[model samples]
Target: MGKPTGFMEYERSVSHAEKPKERIKHFNEFHQPLSMEERKCQGARCMECGVPFCQSGIIIGGMASGCPINNLIPEWNDSIYRGNMKQALSRLMKTNNFPEFTGRVCPAPCEAACTCSLNGDAVAIKENELTIIEHAYEEGYFKPNPPKVRTGKKIAIIGSGPAGLSAADQLNKRGHSVTVYERSDRLGGLLMYGIPNMKLEKQIIKRRINIMKEEGITFVTKADIGGNYNAEEIMKSYDSVILACGASNPRDIKVPGREAKGIHFAVDYLKATTKDILDRNKTLTPDFKNFTITAKGKKVLVIGGGDTGNDCVGTAIRQGAISVVQLEMMPKLPDQRADNNPWPEWPKVAKTDYGQEEAISLYGEDPRVYQTTVREFIADEQGNVCKAKIVRLESKFNEESKRFMMEEIAGSEYEIEVDMVLIAAGFLGAQSYVADAFGVELDVRTNVKTDAGNYQTNVDNVFVAGDMHRGQSLVVWAIREGREAAKAVDTHIMGYSNL
Candidate 1:
């Protein structure tokens, strides 16, 4: 405890984000970090309670309650309060291999489980984490330190997303030769393309990839493990193979006119836009041609109400969409926690993300239309989506079925003009091709099957992790899965694991 009454004495604060309209002008990180003094004050707000649930990383009420990696929140927050960033970074790296990525993208369950949030604001653990790691980088303290000894074990990881990268990092540090294969034209997988530049710049990923390269971990891009590349060859070459390929299959809305030319999967749209931005080296001009399935001068409809949906809203606005609207099948959550929800549990509440914020600023209303789903897309003679048929939905609990189900309201149907449609309805599971190529079994959820509390697959010397093993999840969870899978591989190789 840096200060016994720090919780009471100092209030919580965080980085100041750029105004929505201004930030939409370009796709880059928009948050302005607080000064060292203000950040220190924010760190001092940590209560460091007897039972620090902030780092517990437990599941409460079916949701992650804290840092899934069990980050040493209190220890690092105290270090920040004392202005010892070196110590803070050390503590953070002890558990999380990629704090910089998490600091920027993670939803920060740690803050939700903070004791202080029971009454007031939680300590700025995420922001404090970002400050520490960013400071270390600027001071050259965050650098490569390769393992001194080689374990003489070779490992191959498929997919270069967060999970695969973390697994390679861990196994390499354990003195195992690690080679990562990415199917995409570039590395970072979703981190490289699926996400827009405003959330996380591509250069940030490149910087870390450079460090990993210096540390002796080999990365191979444009190498599809199960696609054109031979999967059996990998298993034969490497002592053990870890499949960290994320859940790459996007779910689709099986409504009428689903094959409209102007409609696209959210991931594909985002990837194209991001790649265009990187290639052109600038934001698309407002008057630029909408030669492909882009949002320019179009009234866009996003068919989901999650982070990806919000991302679509923001991306469309930047692409000069005339208007944007999002549809959600579920009912809107309460502004505050309900009776069934309490402290230390993941709060299910309404949040207006950056994309929605921008939409509201420009369109004068929230883009999300809850309890609504598109029934069909109306395409033009040219086979482009010209409008959408949407219907209001109501929830009903069937006594026998024992679950609440969404049913359409008979008279609540409506039609609206739309030029482009983006489906942000989340992922299904790991694409089956990879699993088939590896000849690994899949569970009921279609995720790679392993015994409970394990990462190894039914096939010996084969393992899985991240979304591929656990279904679609957060980046933090992916990192946790990767680290855990690395341990399993290490143990299997040496008959024991000190990883």
Candidate 2:
């Protein structure tokens, strides 16, 4: 702790963001970074408790409470407070491979679980972290550090997403020849495509990829293992294979008129939009086509109340959508923490995400409709989605199944005209083509079957991580799994791992 009374002396300070109306004109990051002096004050607020629940990463009441990767929160905060940004970044990188990505996108459970939050506001842990790493970059601290000796073993990673990138970083540091194969035309699977440039700029991802390349890690893009290249050839060539392909298969609505032309998956729509932006900016330099899905002057309807759904809402508003409405089957959560929710636990409260805030600023009302779902889609004469038939639902806990189920109420049906529908319900599991091509066994949920403690699959020389193994999850969890799987793969190759 830099100052024992820091929490008492200084109030919590957070970074300011651009006004919603101004930011809706274009797709760019709007969150302002805190100044160095302000960052120090924020870091000093870390109580650095004896227990330090910020790094505990426990699942209190079955919800995540702290940093999932067990980040050294107090140590880094002190380092920042003491004006030792180099030391602060070193501490931050000890656990997380990509602090820059997490700094911008993570929900910051550490702040929610902070000891100071009981009465006062929590320390600005997320901002402090972002400041440390950005300072490191500005001071020329980040550079390529290649391994001294090579293990002479080759490993194939079957995805270039967060999990695969984390695994590649660790395994390469352990002196193994690691090659990441991506089916997309460019690297950084979701990082390059699924996410908007405004949230995580593609240049940041490219900078890290360039550094990894300089450190002898190879990335081969547009290499589809199950389709273009033979999976058998990969198995015979590499000593071990890590399947880090994320869960890309989107969940679909089975209602009538689902086959309408204007209906699309949230991932597909986001990918296309980002790709167009990248192409127009000449970042990727691909021949641009006139494939347009713009929401300009069109009524937008987003189905599901998750992050992806919110992303769709934000993207539509930015594209100049005339109006937007998001539907959630479950009832709205309480505005504040409920009786069942306690301190140091993730609060289940109604909070405005970035997208909703943008929508409300533009439309003069909150766009979310709680306790509602689309029963069917209405198509125009051209077989394009023009409206949605929605119904309010009542949720109850099923005693036998121990799950919350929703049932549509009688005489609660309504209709809303719309030009586009984005489905963001959730993902079921990873696509089965690659898994089936390798003849790998799958669990009941269709995720790759792996033995506990050993992330290896039933198929010989094949390992799995990320959503392919554990189902859809946070980026932090995927990075952890990737690092652990790399250690396992290194052990399998050299008969032992120093990773």
Candidate 3:
């Protein structure tokens, strides 16, 4: 370690965020990163523990503990403390290909598993990573370095999300010709559309895509493999096919007025807003006529209390929503870790994210209604949603069922006026159309079925990874899956993988 007593001398510090009330007026990212010198002190706070659980990537209590990519945390921290910015960037790129994406949006399982977090605040690992990568970009350390040689093997990836991009990056580095196909108008499937612009700006994605283009990777936008394009022909042309198409089939809530005019899936709502933002930026016109699912001047009701729901709250607020409320069937998590959730496991605690904070600042209370669910939707004569019948729920262990069950509390039903409903209750798995078109079998949960130890499907040369294979998951996991799947495809084509 560069400084043995640095952890004792320094305290954890992170980025400064724009105030909630001010930031809610726009859809831009709110975080302002710390300066280089202050970030170096944060790097010095890494205690360099003997085990260094921050890089373990272990599953404790059925949740991921650390960096799924198994980053070399201590090495990079030491490099940063010694003022070796280039070396730190090199070490960072060794494990994770897209630090810019994960540093901004990842929930930071590494911090939860940090040795310092057992007693005090964890080392600012995520923020330090952001600083290192951004510094490398600013200092021109990142350049378009095409492979010196080509292996003559061509690969096609179905999706252009993090997993697909990571796989393409690794395979390209291994000197293989990689082509990424995206169905959207632009590149970056989920990163560009599913996530709100406030969390990750679209320019960051475009910058990386341009560099990849310079490195000889082909990106085909508006190319739908299963629907518009010929999926079978694509498979025959490429030596191997990796399906990184994310799990995008939203889990919808079935209620009385589900077919109402103003109800939409969360993904549709988010994608439309992002497209509108991008389109308006490109052209001088601020036209939004194409977007059907909007929250303007409406009392919006979001179902589910997850990250997606939070994003909806933020987006609705920006779209001029009159009021917003989120429903969650499960009880709220404790503010602090419980006795059962010990050190090194993901803390089972509450998190007040930027969206929730903004809602509180605007509405004078938190927007989340914990342990409540929508029972029915009331619509007007025009078939437009107008209100939601909500009910309080009690969770109890049912002995016969041998599982926790949600029971509606008696005399707890009530109604609230709402003009729009957005279902953000997470996703089930990949959409059936793509899997069906490829003739690939799916697991019971609707995720692509693959052997436990492999990324290949039952059909030869057809591979699946990321959320499509592992169900709805974090961005870091998607990157890890993409890297692993790229290696699998590389080995399947050639004798073995050098990725």
Candidate 4:
């Protein structure tokens, strides 16, 4: 309630994205933040309702309805409307430990559940949040303030992704010594490699890690907990251990010629490109004269149409891919939400993500082919994938299971040139090595198992969070899980928890 009629008076405005063609030229962040005044106006769009669904953080109709971390959206929006960046950030950090990362990569379920979306465009909650944090950084609001006292207790966090970082931050602030171990040569786990630079520049992650180091959190890299390091030794050393290693085991499609050399998991392919970018200190627009797994001049076929697949499409185009086709098992969704997908529920609609936009701009066609899948990979004399046999699929009701299932359509198989294939069919579960080494049990889905609504593992003094505890999910959800897991660990150690 900065202004009673603020919602009516101001129209929602968000940050502008660079032209697709121009942005694809560099592997860097493309969205330009709005000016302070403009962002303040956007903040004015918050209605501040009696029951603000924006922060409810509940599931409705089998989908997440609002901010999973329960951010105080209205309060921060009011702070912004009144030009109080400090207050805005203060309210923001109360719940979310890393607004900077969420503001960039999150899908913004808060906006989807906004009351304003019932009638008009939703408030630019994400950008307003980004503005608050970025402004805080530009100013001197962020400071490395270590805990004044130590609890004489030590904890080990396996993984340096969002979840592990947040958990380490919380426990360290609670006066407990925290150490995070990452198997990767660099820290941030997937943030360092799996994600492309254009979405989130690597420097931002470095900035946060540097501050955490100053705040008395220790990070160990190239430490493979289950393989190189002894899990039993770690259990003996730490008062408590938190496993935040994300679900890194990617699901693979079983098809003929799956062993072809040109076929790779999406995670590995993205990591290769990112590592090359970081090593070269610049975006190397590849000019591959021969097949080196880089997408230069390759006719690429991406399996699955999730965010990862879209990322592959974008990355390949930037690496000078001659052509790209994305296959989805499900059919394309409607441009607008259907009647079943009412407001306040997650809207089921087709979204053209940035990568697809780039592909369309350059290729003059959407690279995604819905309701189709790869039947086989056709390899050349050298046993490298040369083309893919695609088969169209149709949804049919199964009488026995009483569910819809996708079946291959008859006489719908076709072949197209494909020098590279990236499978982005989502993740199955956490890698079994870490859990096996620790003797942690796994659920039916292969996620680390625990009692429902609990973070404690079967073993004493061991806890789990993030993708390892749940499944592959957003960074925002991972942070929430880590914070919650920290609370459980703190309680077990101190006899009572105040996290």
- lDDT at 187, model 2: 90
Misplaced by over 4 Å in model 2 are 282-291, 399-402
- In each prediction, how many residue pairs overlap at the backbone (N, C-alpha, C within less than 3 A)? 0, 0, 0, 0
Candidate 4 C-alpha lDDT tens digits along 13-84: 778899999988778899888999988888888999999999988999989999999999999999998999
For model 2, residues 1-499, the per-residue Cα lDDT tens digits are 7989999999998889999988876677889988899889988999999999888888999888999889999999999899998889889998989888788878888888999987878899988888888888898998899999998899999999999999999999999899999999889888888778778888889989999999999999999989997899999999999999998778899998999988889999889888887777732112333336777778999998988889999988888788999998888999878888988899888888999999988899999999999899989999989989999999888898999899889999999999999998988887889998788888888888998867899988899989888888888778888989998998887888877
Clashing pairs in model 3?
none
Give the C-alpha miss distance for residue 364 in model 1, angstroms. Answer: 0.5
TM-scores for the candidates: 0.98, 0.97, 0.98, 0.98
- Candidate 1 residue pairs that clash: none
Where is the poorest 10-residue window by lDDT in model 3?
A: 282-291
- List where candidate 3 sits over 4 angstroms from the true fold: 282-292
TM-score of candidate 3 to 2 decimals: 0.98
Tens-place lDDT digits, model 3, residues 1-499: 9888888999998999999878866678889988888888988999999999999998988999989999999999988988999999899999999999998999999999999999999999998888888998999988888999999999999999999999999999999999999998999989999999999999999999999999999999999888899989998999999999999889989878788889999999999889888987731123433445678789999998999999999888877778999998989999999999998999999998887888899888899999999989998999999989999999989999999998899999999999999999999998899998888999999999998968999877899999999999999999999999999998899989778
- Least lDDT summed over 10 consecutive residues: which range in candidate 2? 282-291
How good is model 2 by TM-score? 0.97
**Which is the winner by lDDT between candidate 2 and candidate 4?**
4
